[model samples]
Target chain A: MSDTRIIKKRYIFMASVFIGLALLLVILPEKSTSKQLKPEQLLLQINDNNRYVSTDEDARKIIAGDNYMQLIDVRSPGEYVEFHLKGAINIPIDSIFNKDKNGDYVYEDILNQDVKINVFYSNGTVYANQVWILLKRLNYKNNYVMKGGLNRWIETVIRPPKPSVTATVNEVALYNFRKAASMYFGGGSVAVPAEDNAPAPIIKKKPKQEEEGGC
Target chain B: MEEVKIQQNTPRKYMNPYLAGVLLGLVILFSFYLTREGLGASGAFKRGVAKVEQIIIPAHVNSEKSAFYHYVKNGEDPLKNRLVYMIIGVFIGGFLSGAINHRLKLKLEHSPKITSKTRAIAAVIGGAIFGIGSAFGRGCTSGAGLDGMAVLATSGFVVVGMIFGVGYLVAWFFRKLWI
Candidate 1:
């Protein structure tokens, strides 16, 4: 064949491959089919109504009680080791949809169609929210994210006296709120008398000093 | 005879834009299928910055004060990541494709209407802005925007629209940067 004809044939082949790829991208379903939520929509949802919990009242119950829900820590492995909810299993966010030895994600082992799975994060709830969205896309029902993440937990729950050198006062305030909120839910301290009539159930934690406590 | 000689000297043409775009989409899909992740570009840049910060301000980079310090302090080899490898693959792929199509050249690409200096300056400025924006938006064209969208991330579309909108809205003022 002439050089011009050879070039024309190559062009045709490349064009066909390109077209095929475009079609594939068009057809793939990366997100869920249910009413999709935009970042703006999610933000609006949080602001308009606190439909999402930073950490639910039942968190302590789950962590301590006999019949407990599985706690999945989606943060990095190191973060998981540094400090995480007691009894929570570490499944790094990166490894969530990742394949294993058989080249399949471990999602099936942790959950089935009926189970309720809760996720939380360190700072503002972006990563956990992302995972929540992913689970929704995968058609998993009853999956929820602990809003405000660990940041909210540290801010509201932990209330460790401000680490003077590292963070600012405002940062400390936020950290206190997050820390307090986490322990409020994770600690199972609902028995404290409510000062407000709104009746928000307070979480109570077993004293850390108490020896032989449940893991 | 002159026409034949002219054809012999001219470099091979670039792949059609539509074709290139489609191939890029497939590359993204293939990445998702194999690794359950999408293609990323700015992350590689961030890692590059992290490596630099490690050398210059080791303490600050390792401290909680800096946003990037957390990953480094985790004992995670920031470079030993799938995205980093994928980015290297992207460079190799782009260069190889360019070579096979005979479009490879050492010079910078710019519009005919702009001066080389202006183009170069714009490239640098654009790159820097892109670097910062990607960090905030959580990725750039390839990373957050495209990959996020392919995975059906709502934020992906938001960032993509914002980036393009901002680019177009400001493009008029920077007309001198490009034709």
Candidate 2:
């Protein structure tokens, strides 16, 4: 073959090969679908008002002892132990979706079950909302954020401002209900009764007493 | 000095540079897609060296004296990693390609002006310097430099540019080795 012919052939071959590679690169997602919700869908979910369970609703559910409702404190273990709802379970915001050795989510039963409604709360909605968004994005149903979190719950239930004397019947009824709940939760926010599901102190070592009579 | 011809008759059969580059680009992209991480040549080697040291002196692996404590800290196994396997795959793939192309040989490749022994000595010294440099730079040419370029990171451009710029400047002093 002549030099010109060989060189031309090589150029064409190179060009065609490159174009083929470019096409492959364009199609190179390799076909894997993420089950997580898209960003826009997640944003909409975040904005939706129905994702929140008001403190009143939360309180009513606890009062009724709804077997289907689960209160999840999305705070540090320390914070949860410091003060949380009467029957709240601690699931720190960071570890909500972590998996066990078997590759199943550690909180999968509590998080994704339709039989149980998981209501997450923190000192504020920030931590609860974070956990809620992540679980919601992962397509977990029956999960909700406790509106205004524990702070609002305390303001409304524990130290409820008495309704105005001219308040409507419904307002008076709500105040009475809150007053009843406040008393049920051990009156004025002393972290419920210590005997009522309060976790024992984690540091078990007794204080060492120096020798009383000897050096 | 006569102008050196880079291409000569019977130029060994090798894949086109452009083809190789495209393949490498695809590999890098796929690496990120699969691992959510970039291609890194030094990380595997670093782990390998650390693992070897751990096997030789188990106590030294985690002690302050060991330079590679980071790899084996908290009883972590440096060898049990995807990168180590990736490095092995790289070696096997390179060998297969070279064999298929009839480019597999035992001879050392060097400039015609230098003896094989001089080339060998220079390569060892140059590689040692580059190994130290990669540690300081946090990754080697393909990992930190090329991977950065693949993602259009400014750091990649800076690293590649500095490598070539310094190379050119030093090549003037070492021209006798080649020319």
Candidate 3:
């Protein structure tokens, strides 16, 4: 074939490929059929809405016998077996979408439930946050993340700290609430020493050094 | 025969770079508006790799431990991914552009100073390094540099700066290949 003819053939081939791809894009099923939230809108929701539950708030809800609230432990099965919040159901993050012998999603029934609230917690906020986002994308309603996850739960509930004497009224009140929550959860709480009334020391951070130029 | 000769000899001029850039920006904006995400190039490569891995070791591709498994686990065709489709469109658009400009000749592009073999070797090395870098960076130039910069992301600025800085720094050593 001549040079121009070959070029024309190549151009026609490319055009055909382009048309084929465009058709495929239009015909193929989407990854998700549900109306999914945009990343920007998701970010806005995360920042604007109260998506996190404080350890105190979680403890209060659990202790108050709130049947409408569901606590989902999103950690590994081994981690969940070791110790988890009372009345919390273990749903390892990996197996959230496992298929049963009947070819139905294992958590389909649970996820489809019309619960008032479903609080997901993991070792930290990362895993829970991931699960939350996934559930949100699936159009699951009333999903929340346990702020700071089990780490914060251990710090605030398992070891309630006593406020210093010089602490503000709000700080002291919050400490008291935490103490009460600790007692309800059967966690140990230390008494505030009268002699230890000094204000907490404020440490000044060193200035960050400028980054070196060039990669 | 005379008309054919005239047509073959006449090559159209290329579009202005500024206009091309503006058009590219608009395309990126429209992509973001439609999909809630910007354009990406390396993701198509990753999906391609995952598809290849799946074909080679089906069990390994389905294993929970495999990082690539997620791409194919949803029963979705890897080639059908949005990025893969975008890449196909890119190839087609590039070829069409070259054809329109009468610049679609099949030949290796290299400076006269370097042999085609040397250029080929350099290209392979450069592509391999770029693939690894893109994997680490979580994106390629089109995805991270252009799309991220279009959104005014901090990482975008940093990556683009690093790319040009490193390119300039190493250009002198490989001056013979191009200059």
Candidate 4:
């Protein structure tokens, strides 16, 4: 073929290839983890009790220093500064989607990963639930809302009402556990022995086998 | 047979710039899809420098005051990272592409107007300045220009504009080296 003919053929192929890639991108529309669920799918999960990690469980994780449990305080920065659960990382509700200085979504790796169960809490359920719904809609898994937020933590873990004399053995045992937790958190004087309780991991990881090594 | 001899004697024609650009865009898109990270070289180079510092002066890499300490802190090995592997792949791929095009050769490249020694010195100075600029910009051309633009990032567009804009604006001063 002539040089001009060869050049024309190459140009046409390049143009078509470029146009095809553009069309593919448009058609796919962010086929990544951008899995924005339909309202129906989201609604089905909104009422799912499993979305919540109870105050007791949250306290247990905190006390045990569970590596796989990441506590996120989803409140205003001022609220976070005033008080938050021990070891919680504060990501203000509004700034959850904002990227940090390094251009990564603020605490996004924790929100998106499965190795750790990200427990989000605020003053109440509203902010925490908002974060939960937002992350869930974006198809992020392994995130849970702390059922009653800081309010519940305060009520159950910080200052539990003493069990009545008629209370069951289990209720009495739970009260004693909370009493110990209150002391640990500097909210009570009674230094009761903490229960040897660690919340089970949300995700059951497969036992890691040793790698057979060779370069 | 005659055409084949001529082809062997000359470098192959370069790929069309538009086609190469589109391919690079696709590569960046796929990299994001698979790794959830941009394809950048400078960050990896930074990590490599951090590793070298650790090897040469272990104390310096561990010191909090040292800039490279960030990469080598807490017993973390930056050399074991994915970005480092990507850079290694880039070197091998570049060589392979050059060989395929019959452009593979080890020789000093200098403009006719400039001596080879001058070219070498200018390259070293230019590279050092570019390295400093990349550090300040948080990325080099490949990272900020191609990958950033691929994602429609504002920083990426700004970097690319600054690179060419500044290059053209200052080219007059460097014209003697080329012309």
Q: Please, what are the lDDT tens digits per residue for candidate 3 over residues B17-134?
A: 6558768889989988998678888888888887888888878878887666667776756677688888888899989988766777879999999899999999999999998888
**Residues B63-131 of candidate 1: C-alpha lDDT, one tens digit per residue:** 888767644776666576666787788899889977665567789888898878888888898788777
lDDT of 3 at A39: 85
lDDT of all predictions, in order shown? 0.64, 0.79, 0.77, 0.80
Q: Give the C-alpha miss distance for residue A166 in model 2, angstroms.
A: 43
Better of 1 and 3 by DockQ: 3
Comparing 2 and 3 by lDDT, which wins? 2
For every model in order, what is the number of clashing pairs?
Answer: 32, 0, 0, 0
Cα deviation in Å at residue B7, candidate 1? 7.3
lDDT of 2 by residue, B1-179 (tens): 11232232222456767778878889889988997667777878888888888888888877988767877888889878777777788899989877655566778888898999999999999899998888776677977798888888787888889899999999999886778
* Model with the higher lDDT, candidate 3 or 4: 4
Q: Candidate 3 lDDT, tens digit per residue, A1-215?
A: 69889878877986787699879989998775666778887777767548788877888888797877778889997776667786778788998889999976677656545535778999899999988888776666677899999889879886867788899999988888887877766656323211222322221332233221111
Candidate 3 residue pairs in backbone clash: none
Chain A of model 2, TM-score against the native?
A: 0.74
| DockQ agreement of candidate 2 with the native complex | 0.01
- DockQ, in order, for the candidates? 0.01, 0.01, 0.02, 0.02
Residue-by-residue lDDT tens digits, candidate 1, A63-95: 355233555668887766666664456667777
Q: What TM-score, to 2 decimals, does candidate 2 have?
A: 0.52
